[model samples]
Target chain A: MQRRFGDQEVDICIVGAGAAGGVLARDLARAGLKVVVLEAGPFWDPQQDFASDELSMQKLGWQETVLVAGNNPLKMGHNNTGRGVGGGTVHFTGVFLRFHESDFRVYSQDGVADDWPISYADLAPYYDRIEREIAVSGPKHFPWGPFAGPYPYPEREPLSANAVVFRQGCEKLGIKSAVTPLAILSAPFDGRPPCINRGFCNQGCLPNAKFSTLIQHIPQAIAAGAEVLPDCTVTQVEVDEKSRRVTGVIFVHDGTEYRQPAKIVILANFVVQMPRLLLNSATPAFPDGLANSSGMVGKGIMPHSSYDVYAKFPEEIRLYKGTPVLATTQDFYETDHTRGFVRGYTLHAHGARPVAMATGISVGAGTWGPQLRRAMLDFNFYARITQVGEVLPSEKNTVTLADEKDDNGLPLPLVTFGYGDNDLKLIDHAVAKMKEILTAAGGKPEFVIPDTAHLMGGCRMGADPRTSVVDQWGRTHDHPNLYLAGAPIFVTGGGVNPTETVMALAARTADHLIQQARRGL
Target chain B: MATKSHYPHYNVLDAAEDWDPHTRKIVEARLLPLESVEHLTTAETKTLYSVVAALIDDDRSEILDYVVKHFDDTLGKRIGESQRKTGVPPQADLIRRTLSGLGKTARDNYGKPFPELTVDEQHTILGQLERGQIPADGIWMNLPQKEAFTKLLSLTVEAYYSHPKIWSEIGHGGPAYPRGYVRTGPGLVDPWEAQREE
Candidate 1:
């Protein structure tokens, strides 16, 4: 039976129990506030439910139908973003890197995209706190992004054969490479064992070594008096007609509708769902949608335009034995207009599993029958380098309500995206650079897989109410009590994974809420 | 009795046998026959088998039977139900129409059905279909022939590779569960993993 709450009232009601929601839940509940998190998916225990299957993990990703259209259309939903209590963190490869100082002032520095309302300095403390809280492991003194201190845990040792070969290429090409900062524990910390290098981090680590919010934050939050309601879909956010303040959220659990009243409502659902929820909550006073006074709620959706370059080697590499994405080089992370691109892309060695490799060889390698069979036999000799590049915000690349409705009778999200000229140039340069790196390591570049890694933007935060949805604190200008969390607040997506920054901003938002509550909010 | 030469180290349910109970269930669930095949007609299933056999260069009737059944079971109900902008037909209809087009191509080019064509002839017909070289007014026109071939080929390859016998031949590590990796440093191999004989 689905657990039902009788009170239907809490000091704070969070929409999604993802990276941001998990942090907010623990922090808010620990601050003595009655917090409740509504997760639209099941909560799986790591040790009990994790596995090493590609098919199962694909299902764990959001599979519900989403309409994607543009000059360069994207395959959304299933292939990207997880659908569970831990959200994307459940299936994340755990490459957590801090945003560069240039990431904060992209607009001011490059004359493109809007600069973040809050600086990196403002979010530095939270990043340090989250890294310490999660026991992040990395190289001790990496001259990459600015950080307050060294990694909380020691670095993961003995890089994968794929990374070793890729690093040889990096050295030959004069690119600085380092041990990727990872949430996967490198040593025993807080009773959790170190990573055994299971090679299935993308498939949900069974050993509980990978730091998913499901393993840490959710449990702490539950212990700190935060109620977690899984398998519950929030359909609409009801607001007071006269005051325009969010009254409560109407959700469906086990086919039964429940209205949970709250003093504050936080939408921490990943990029796509967050904007969909806001647009679905249109009221008479706010027809364009609640907290969408600027009409920027679902606009400017950006999932980093990414691609993968795979190379064939003469000898076996056994790229699948270690953590997926064991090493990453951000040498190309900073923009250089001389390189013929306005922004840059981060290139990393891909730790692809057997099933993923088989699929890639069959489709991407351009072989079939006896040749395909030979390629599959030679799978151990291939290595992949992935590019995660920034895409400047465009008014056209957006998330809107689809014509079709979901199982719950709510309209599905329709994402329309197209690569800009600058994006195309960056992708071309990144792919060429990756090929050069592979060539330097005595491997032949084989194929390219056009894909996106992280999703950001829609419901972006800014100081101007007329131009952006939420303020720097993630507080919506229309509803002072309503706040947004996670990648949706990013004014500009950095050339790195967005998970660490999402958690950091959540910490900052929680502090903001605590300060506001002290002022009788 | 001599040990089997082909699939010499085959375990019928390697993943299930190696994985913990929970992980085993997940792997087992996919292996079970999908209920979606009930939506396809017996003739449609037969056509799928023949087309898949031609595409993958598999002549064994049983392999063709298993491949088509697996594809139908997994994706029969959803085919042709939704159309992406890429022009790939709905899952069900794509299989139906593509097979229909292949049979027509076989008849038009060599005056024989696809299943009756020689292996080389079958490859010729498939190549034309894959390259979008088939006549414009026919079945392959409306469908994205290349994308359709890609989708079908991918599914066929997945089904073939997923079998226990193939796992042995390809030297896969099977499932990682209670026994996760330990010797995972650069070029390191665990004792249990498949070692390439010199």
Candidate 2:
């Protein structure tokens, strides 16, 4: 039964109805638990709200101010984070990939970054479940990762010119490449039609072809008796004064404050907001923060060193002809000490729209005036390759509360991030490889746009309470009923798209919560 | 003088009718006339217009007016990138102060307003601003010159390329929606896609 805000306590309250929260709400509510979800942004109806224009679709991203510091100040919004019910999934490129076995044991294999509390074997089943649920389409035999063989849906066909060029280059270099595993539907599933090669996946899919939590999990969650409150921003997580267990959450809806009491509270927001909320909810009982026993609420944040290498091809490579990323190679995904970098990166044949291409040239190459205009005029002849280089975790990179307040009268988050020496070395190696691949495919390598994406960590999970905020099952070390169910719990960010892993972790967390409920805890 | 396009035969608006209703509405809104100036003053608006024209290397009044109005709307709504480098003010404040500084720099250095300066002189001042070589005086004090220049350039480029006219010039296929492309193979082209004249 759907429970509303009143004096009675509900079974669960999940904050931020994005990837993780959507899954948790659906699973818990289906099990007969009264669940309520609070989302900070509007609940969009894809057909009514989505547009093909890049400038307008940027509304899907979190537009609140975040103060950035450090040598390489990270650019927030559209590229890295998201707003609204579906979160980043609504605007993401839909590149669904599973982390390799080595990604789980980064410390043991590469001697850098901390090891995940759980192994790949623990997540492999959940990964399989998520791929089937979302109908991920890919090659019959995946070139990388432990689990191989046919995905739930067949691979997308008629490769875009950019993908074909990238594969040709990889083939010439004797490197293995494959059609990228994508959450985008290639065949009709669950009444939704297949992709029509719109090439606006990053601008929010208009045809309902791409899988997002807003269209899939959230609807199922609502049908399963969960009350999903959109445009409701949770300000603080309330805890019991004596027991120290989470009581519920205080949120603002339509300029009115209300409290929803629940037996359990899960923070499913991403890297920046998750820690910001915890630190903001500090009380006298837990002076530092709610889950600050280890003092690791907002430390060790990592963003993959994503850099795009644009090459000019003689042929018309009209990049915006199909999905943004249709093909990728994981040839350099494992550590090779000979390369002077501790970890490796994945290369994708990424597509670019006109505005994105122009901005990339202007910001990345510092090209302006006549030179910038000339580059954009030949935009149709460019094929781009982007690298997702693994960045090592640094305690120096953090998310702290700023003195300035936001529109909600809460302290704004000040995000500090800078690439380490190893991270820079990894980027250099990846860029060289990208240029070599483009050159081998009969293209002249031109601009290398330095950027980053996929923010993770800040509230990591581990077995030790002294060093980690949550346990392997996402339960907070200090509070038994307070859990985190998204990228914030990541111990190590793998060099691939993170949505699949995020959903898989949420599924596992749901199972754990369901088991605890069965025990009447 | 209007900037000459490499692909003059292509016009992306020819296929505008194929776009979905929501997408078409959003794209069409860009071409609508501005009702009034919401963010910048008249002087600031003229300064921004000149700066955008110099940054994009385009002199067409229609394109310049649209770009300036689009930027003004972005500032008024506070929809631009909210993340800022430490110590830098908000985007609106940064842009306003930088425009004022550019005008003052032109008057002090060349004895004229920024818009009245020759194209070559304007380019030189812009280069100095981008390289952080300009002296910090008056409104330029504590200002991040390179960051400000990059922000201005990025915003201008975004607005310039977003125009359907620029899309035609760049041979871009605008807004594929209900009817998406079928010929996606190497060197293949849809009938409505841009074709370069040999």
Best by DockQ: 2
TM-score of chain A of 2: 0.98
Report clash pairs, candidate 2.
none
**Which candidate leads in TM-score?**
2
Model 2 whole-model lDDT (C-alpha atoms): 0.89
Per-residue lDDT over B1-198 for candidate 2, one digit per residue giving the tens place of the 0 to 100 score: 124565789888888888888888777776765566778898898888889999999988778777888778778874336588888878888898899999999999999999999999999999999999899978899999998998899888888888888889988888998999899998788899888785
Q: Could you give candidate 1's per-residue lDDT for residues A1-521 as a string of tens digits?
A: 34445556678999999899999999999998988899988898776666676655665677665666788766554445777888888888898889999999998889899899989899999988999999999988776778633799888887888888888999998888888889999989889888877678888878889998898999999999989999888999989877768877988988889888889999998888888999999977889888898999889988887688878887667666788787788888887979987768788898786567766666655566656666666666678898889988898988888777777888878788898888889999999999999999989987677777778999999999999999999999999778899999899888888999999999999999998888876
List candidate 1 segments past 4 Å from native: A1-4, A361-371, B1-18, B25-37, B54-70, B76-113, B120-147, B185-187
lDDT for every model?
Answer: 0.79, 0.89
Q: DockQ score of candidate 1?
A: 0.33
lDDT of 1 by residue, B138-179 (tens): 565777787677777877877666554455555566666667
How good is model 2 by TM-score?
Answer: 0.98
Q: Candidate 2 DockQ score?
A: 0.64
| Worst 10 contiguous positions by lDDT, candidate 2 chain A | A1-10
- Least well predicted 10-residue stretch by lDDT in candidate 1 chain A: A1-10
Alpha carbon lDDT at A312, candidate 1 = 84
